[model samples]
Target: MQNMRIVKKPGYAVDSVDRALQLILLLQETEWLRIGQAAKALGVAPSTAHRLMSTLVYRGFALQDDQHRYCAGPALHPEPAVGAERALVAAARPHLEALAARVQETVNLVERVGATARYLATVEGPQLLRVGNRAGTILPAHVSAAGKAILSTLPDEMVSAVCARQPPHGGSALTAAEMQELQAELRDVRSRGFAVNLGRTEPDLAAVGAPLASGNRPAALALSISAPLSRARQIQDPAAVEALLTCCAALRLELETQGRL
Candidate 1:
């Protein structure tokens, strides 16, 4: 005769709070849940599941229908601001494109990623022959105007940590004293509301970058334009600087109003 084995129920008990919360998160992606189905899936008793659902409903994190089903409640979700970075890119793209066309220079969107500044997007100038930095490319924060513009808004300690974490292009990285001097330069950037990098990242290349803010995150985005050093000198022109400032102002307004620029 074939051996027959009987299976025994596991003695371990799952935590009720975690299970209920997991169900809540799962429901976020779904429309509604029937009591029987939800309880069965959670491996909990119907009465216990009903009590948990009642608590969620009481707190406005869930709602129950007359048909005896539950759905997510208004309090379960706050206005989503988590995708602010993507929103920032979308918000800044048109302006960057227009500016690139007008100036015939490479325009880029840059953001801080860990200890370095990473390119978020790039729009090339009118010239058929143009150099473009790929999105996700990173550079030292101290070297690039696009990096420095955003760095200028960070706290001194945080800036020091970031710079100390990586060596500068030429040597053993910036000293604390040198970091202070660089901080002074950033202060100027703050006052000027823009930063200038002349052959710091790439030889014979010059760039100008301005900051964009959203909510309490200061200088969350940087807008930049780059050109050959000779052509970059044109950035010193009063009219060009004015135009850059105007664009920065517009970006700031857009970020403030739309909460993403």
Candidate 2:
């Protein structure tokens, strides 16, 4: 991240607790984090950083690599999240199938999680060659089609804050310039009412997605259609977009009626 976005600290915020929480957020953002980087980000001494990380490692919330860099550990993902997602998958199944039938391509449902998007469910297409199921997959929110759509629904400042934490690791990480470009893309997605991914997440694959609402309020859920790069144009067609939006609306309405949204 080129610049640190300002976080409004609560008046009663506990310094040790807050620093530990910030460290957790940092670990969650980057694939790997050096102790020095953590100390710098949290404005704590290197010794304090080590002690903090020791606690996280003890709790299984963080782990150290051979190089001593910190990364997210197993405890970061809890069973409650998976249980809630299972309910979401069941509620959205019919619409996912409908969207898959309409586009005749792989259809996916994703939920935005901080700066990432989690693939909760997918309905594979009938084509001989197509994107397979990505259920339970997690990708950066800025790169995935549905993730962008979900982020577009958030306030601009919130979106910027989310993009600012992009870790400095891997080719998939968005740089400062790339984050700016994503801002521009989100603007178009907001106005166009849908988002597109042209091989951003994976080469030779293209996808389009639209955000959905929960109980009349904007939510972090999106439904997208993925296809082979050769069928990219087909997925972006007006009919495909309409079909996606129609299914999202229907699903949103059903969930709202059932008090599930």
Question: TM-score: which candidate is best?
Answer: 2
- State the TM-score for model 2: 0.67
List ranges where model 1 is wrong by over 4 Å: 1-85, 166-173, 214-217
Error of 2 at 21 (Å): 32
RMSD of 2: 13.5
Task: Encode model 2's per-residue lDDT on 1-261: one tens digit a residue.
Answer: 599889898899989999999999998898888889999999989999988987887555776532366678656867786456567788899889977877899999988877777677789998899898776456778888999999988877888887677433333445778778988999999899899999888889899989986543557789999999999999999999999989988988887787767
Query: Residues 1-261, candidate 1, lDDT per residue (tens digit)?
Result: 999999764567457767778779856866777777778878888888888877776555665542456677655667553245557778888988888877778888887765566677778887865656435455767778888988888887878887877532223567878788889998998887789999887788888987775444667678888887888777656666667767777878977788454
Could you tell me the lDDT of residue 166 within candidate 1?
52
Best by lDDT: 2
